[model samples]
Target chain A: MAKLKNPRGLEDSQVMKMSYWKILSILLLVYTVTGGFLMEVPRLAIVNETIRSLYFHVPMWFGMVVMFLTSTLYAVRYLKKPGAYFDIISVEFANTGLIFGFLGIVTGMIWANYTWGTPWHGDPKQNGAAVALLIYCAYFVLRGSLENSEQRARLSAVYNIFAFAAMIPLIFIIPRLTSSMHPGSGGNPGFNTYDLDRNMRMVFYPAVIGWILLGVWIATVRIRLRNIEDKILELEYEKNH
Target chain B: MKRIISIAASLGITFTGYAQEPEMADGMRSEGKIYVVVAILAVILFGLVAYLISIDRKVTKLEQRLNDGKPR
Candidate 1:
């Protein structure tokens, strides 16, 4: 691996390298897709074979939450240190998070249609997730509206923090408070020994980890591309001046 | 004759007992066709990951080019 100097005097780790986690992500996902379909799932009455969706669908939300959490942390870092690097990281993470969230919602709707009798059940958890994604979408809008790079970074950093805060309660807390059709909410028995039993956890946990790593890898690629763009712009300005 | 008749009846009972299990894709698996599906999915996953890796390599090359004191 060539040692590339980060444009902003950031640590060497900030410079992207082919890491072990990327390999792990690939391996885990391969296992998940294979095992998810073939493995013996609980023969639940309503879900039956569709219960396999748990391995695929649930990971998207888990990956999204992880990405958003990382974004919020970087946003907080930007507030304290005030650097373009942190801001870039924050935005790219949120971008990947949004992708995961969209997949989560789409896959969820498909699974719900067969199990819940409708695509949009207006379940508390579903609404909460939709509301949470909208809040993050507004974060991007907030960033786009500002012209100045510094101003855009600063304002969006604050908004990112707020968005994460709202998402926690909306997606996690509110669903539990209200009677949600979702499992593990509103006194419904979650995927415990009953549903997401020991057999499923073997695949589900790795699937979540694998997907989160994949999301991070994607965000890092975007961040690197953005860095290249910034460097080109800086070099161009220097040449002109 | 009675013994042969009892064996036939027990065979019929066992077949029905086997049918009582929860319906799964056991037929597909028993016929060994599910491996085809697994192979197809694995190939797709590997293909996407390989593509992602290539993009990552391209970005790394760009980073190296810029860091080499040459502006592309």
Candidate 2:
């Protein structure tokens, strides 16, 4: 609340425009690092030490899903309004989502290497996640192939929406339907069943929020960079003509 | 010595939980092993923040190039 007012007492509308992602992400990073490990966890068999991986690994998937959802929302808007701004936002969100998704896979593999005995076991969730990311990867390839900006935006927007739709079943539904080595799959109970203690929830929730905010902040930065690049290109075109 | 035995017992590696002490992930907590993980994490986090800062600097340079360094 105190940050609402300008420190210089100048009448600047930039006050409301600036985001708090930078500061909050740093704070939450500190909170997650210290609190995540120090807190008590449910003493379950096989996943005793690796339960802490829940804080780091699960948040990546959560952040990726949230960022991809945001990307799809913008893609829909681009289809409706047909604006370059929306396209840029959509692409940046996807880019950030890819980073989170990639990190999710890496962390999951590391966790799995210890818990599941293999990095790339044919778990339904793992296979599903891989397919979802592959779909998103094709979206980027689609964008790069097109030369005309408007056509690229239109086509990519459509593809992005479809990718997000398909990813839902891959990530959430199919994992639950078939057997999975991961928790909360097939007949196994979810962590919530054991986490009635709520010891991990305190840090886990904050970790999710923090990672999502960090993704948004990175996307925002990329969007601004895109805008700058667009402006510079426009200026060069004018000078050449 | 005794701690490993208790941990092994508690995790049902040798015996069961009732026969041993409470199960805690003493892997990172003991013998300053936690500090190694802490250091690795700190370095990774620092590297990411540094990368972000570099991006911020690049953006600032671009803004200055586009706007002649004047406030918009």
Candidate 3:
């Protein structure tokens, strides 16, 4: 690892641009918020009114997985480079992903409660999602326990990779191996089963993209705030020592 | 404030009297109640996004102050 005299990590002109994530976020919000509520959906049993939650709730998992994958990619980069830039990015992505995952679980529980007569039914998919969240929760706890920056980054990066590994089987494979209340798993009527109705597909696809882009926007803001914090810490250290 | 509260209480009770489980509109152009749901969702989403934008602006201001090395 190269020791840098300057610890501040803001140098990219492209990142400082105003039109990048902001405009995209606004456009996506406009499309999603309008289309999600207005779009038509099939009247499925039990989930009649709540089928609209697909646009709002189900997309949260899509956003979470996309953000987590982005975080894992940054973790791999941090392992290779050992830079604060990559570490900042890795942590922010993880943070955003965790928020999305938390929302997903809450929405899913609410949806389940109304439909299945319980908030949690020990379904394979629900259990798998809970475990995946626990793994990431442990990652944050691990980071909080460490004081040294490099050691924290290194250890967290390794744990993040392992967390991602556990996430895949928990979310994808286990759900398929057993009965699940979640759609698209274990013979349930799903997007794949019907490929989604025409109107539903139009809004659903945009909703997923919109939520994922919103997650990215949040992550970038967090990264910027963290960068500012890092700069302040470095300046303070220089002034005192 | 008392009047408003009593009015709100009566409205809530009146709505609950006819309410069914998982109330939903038939389609977009059918009943107008779907528009009410749509409006509520729009308000919630807009409020959330706008709050986030406000935080972003505050952070950007702080970042600018740091870059300029000014207390202001």
Candidate 4:
């Protein structure tokens, strides 16, 4: 039998040429070391020195947002093309996004503990973030419980649309309406000002980009693996039959 | 034991004096800063974990498929 070519035509691509895991590791190492050193610097620190957490917390939320946005894109593609690959990519992105969302909440809680004198202050931002995360978690559970691939994909795609729509209000609008000890709320205008100085921005912006790239790199690896697994499963079923 | 007792006594006196002074009562504002740094690091760690897990699941699926195709 002739060898089947990669359907996505990525097998020979430059992106597939390099080891994603190694590149991701190197980027993570650099981010950690540089961020750590910058945080330790005496003068650059803010909010009684708790502002250093911004590097970690803000980036996770940014990464999560990126993942969810990617998921939404794939969901749209799935609706149009009805391909398995798109569904897989969408679910994979959602899984990664949820992990980042949970981290953002944890880090925010820790920051609040020190600055606001408690881990949780019933802040609007906190509550809204929690609700958004829970919605995505439910999406995953719903997908898992379903047995049929086509049904799972269609249902998940529809749910993803709704989840993404709700996310806008939960993450951006609601936080703005109510009181939040968090920087950008309660009539006290958040990070829009020079809250993050030029020096902070130098590291902060790169951290966001790096983390998002890292997220994509991971999702690609996952998609590739899923393809391989499907091929093997097909072979096995053929042999059995 | 005697030296330990003396040290404890000195520390108590120092803390009492610090508490009495309004300025010193604030303790080093540096603690708050450290907390912030820790919180940020925790978030980054979570993102890292998310990335790793996504990759791991894919690899596992691939490996399982490869194994399933082999002859018994």
What DockQ, between 0 and 1, does each candidate earn?
Answer: 0.17, 0.22, 0.15, 0.09
Please provide, for model 4 over A107-225, each residue's C-alpha lDDT reduced to its tens digit, 9 standing for 90 to 100: 99888886566888888888989999999998999899999999999999999999999997898888777655566665555463325477566666767777777777677676767
Give the CAPRI class of candidate 2: incorrect
Q: DockQ (C-alpha) of model 1?
A: 0.17
Tens digits of lDDT, candidate 1, A1-241 = 7755566443455445568889899989999989988887775445657778888888899999999999999999999999999999999999999999999999999998986779999998999999999999999999999999999999999999999999998988888787776776664435543353878888888988998889999999999999998998999999999
Report the Cα lDDT for residue A233, model 1: 93
Candidate 4 has what TM-score?
Answer: 0.70
Ranking by TM-score: 1, 2, 3, 4
Q: At residue A97, give the lDDT of candidate 2.
A: 98
Q: Of the candidates shown, which would achieve the greatest TM-score relative to the real structure?
A: 1
Q: iRMS of each prediction in angstroms? A: 11.9, 7.2, 11.8, 12.6
Kindly list the per-residue Cα lDDT of model 3 for residues A126-173, writing each as its tens digit: 999999999999999999999999999999999999999999889888
Q: How far is candidate 4 from the true structure (C-alpha RMSD, Å)?
A: 10.6
Candidate 4 lDDT for residue A156: 94
The model with the greater lDDT, 1 or 3, is: 1
Q: What is the TM-score of chain B in candidate 1?
A: 0.68
Q: Between candidates 3 and 4, which one is better according to DockQ?
A: 3
The candidate scoring highest on lDDT is: 1
Q: How close is chain B to the truth by TM-score, in each candidate?
A: 0.68, 0.63, 0.59, 0.49
Off by over 4 Å in 3: A1-17, A187-190, B1-24, B27-31
Order the candidates by DockQ, highest first — what do you get?
2, 1, 3, 4
lDDT of 4 at A225: 73
Lowest summed lDDT window (length 10), candidate 3 chain A: A6-15
